[model samples]
Target: MTILLVEDDEVDVMNVKRAFKKNNISNPLVVASNGIEALEVLRSVSPDRPRPKIVLLDLNMPRMGGIEFLKEIRQDPELSSLSVFVMTTSNEDSDKIEAFNLNVAGYILKPLSMDRFISAVSTLNSYWTLCEFPG
Candidate 1:
């Protein structure tokens, strides 16, 4: 399954890439800078390129943040039920509550070390592989 990563930080994006490689996660990855761009990418999916089975979302962004994006998608019938995992630095209980309320699959705090990041990515890889997803 394809993976869509909606993050604004360039360094974090790069870290994800590196972690994926280290974990041997060869799935195709698509990147978006913010929630707005992420919505555009999701909407553009077609039969040839289905919507990503997983979305790694960041909560804080310049335009539409993760919470707003989740609300928009959950309201849209065509986009609802998307598997979204919030990967953010925000430790606020409110953010976590809101994200869970919006039906996020999981909420993960970004790891500080590269080793931890790689381990986290590996866990994700294992999770998706063990689970079934709609095509």
Candidate 2:
């Protein structure tokens, strides 16, 4: 399954890629730098392009943020069922509440250390491997 990672930081993007590689996660990963770009990618109807099975979203971004993106998708009939997980730096209660209210599958705080981040990714890899998603 393809995972869409929406993040603006180049370093963070590289870290996810590195962690996936290190963990031997062979699933295809698609990237979008911000919420708008992510929407464009998700909304595409290209026959050959695979839809992302999940989204790893960052709350703070240019143009549009994660919360707004969640709202947009939830309101759209075709996209409402898509699974999303918040992988962000924010630890605020408001952010957490809002994310849950928007129906995200999970909320994860980005670890500052590389090892912890990789471990988190590995856990997600294992979890997804055991689950079945709608096509």
Candidate 3:
């Protein structure tokens, strides 16, 4: 499964990568620094490669933000059904509600500990790996 990680912070990105590595998730991972970059990656198509199966999004970003990004994706006919999960540091209830309203698959609080981070990644990987998809 291809995964797109949309985060602006370098440290957060590195931590996520470490978690994925610890969990042994071998899917080709893609990085997007912000909402605009994420949109470009999501809409891009390849003749021989499948689109990203999941998007791990961060709420705070420059140029564009996560809620706005979600709105854009929801408005697009082609990308409306794509799975997006919020993996952000923000614990705002308003943000969570808005994300759910916009059809986010899940909202995860960023874990502070390395072990918990790995566990979260493993759980996410397992959930997506077992989910049914169009053939």
* Model 3 lDDT per residue over 46-96, tens place: 866667878999999999899999999999998888889999988999999
Error of 2 at 135 (Å): 1.8
TM-score of each: 0.96, 0.96, 0.95
Candidate 2 TM-score, C-alpha based = 0.96
In candidate 1, what are the lDDT values of residues 1-135, reduced to their tens digit?
A: 889999999999999999999998999999999999999999998788878879999999988999999999999998897889999999999999999999998899976689988888898888889989776
Tell me model 2's lDDT, rounded to 2 decimals. Answer: 0.92
Clashes of each: 0, 0, 0
Candidate 2 lDDT over 1-135, as tens digits, reads: 889999999999999999999999999899999999999999995778877878999999999999999999999998898889899999999999999999998999986599988998898898888989887
- Candidate 3, residue 31: lDDT: 94
Q: Which prediction has more favorable TM-score, 1 or 3?
A: 1
Superposed by TM-score, candidate 3 places the C-alpha of residue 84 at a distance from the truth, in angstroms, of 0.9
lDDT scores in order: 0.92, 0.92, 0.90
Between prediction 2 and prediction 3, the one with superior TM-score is 2
**Candidate with better lDDT, 1 vs 3:** 1
Name the lDDT of candidate 1.
Answer: 0.92
Clashing pairs for predicted structure model 1, backbone only: none
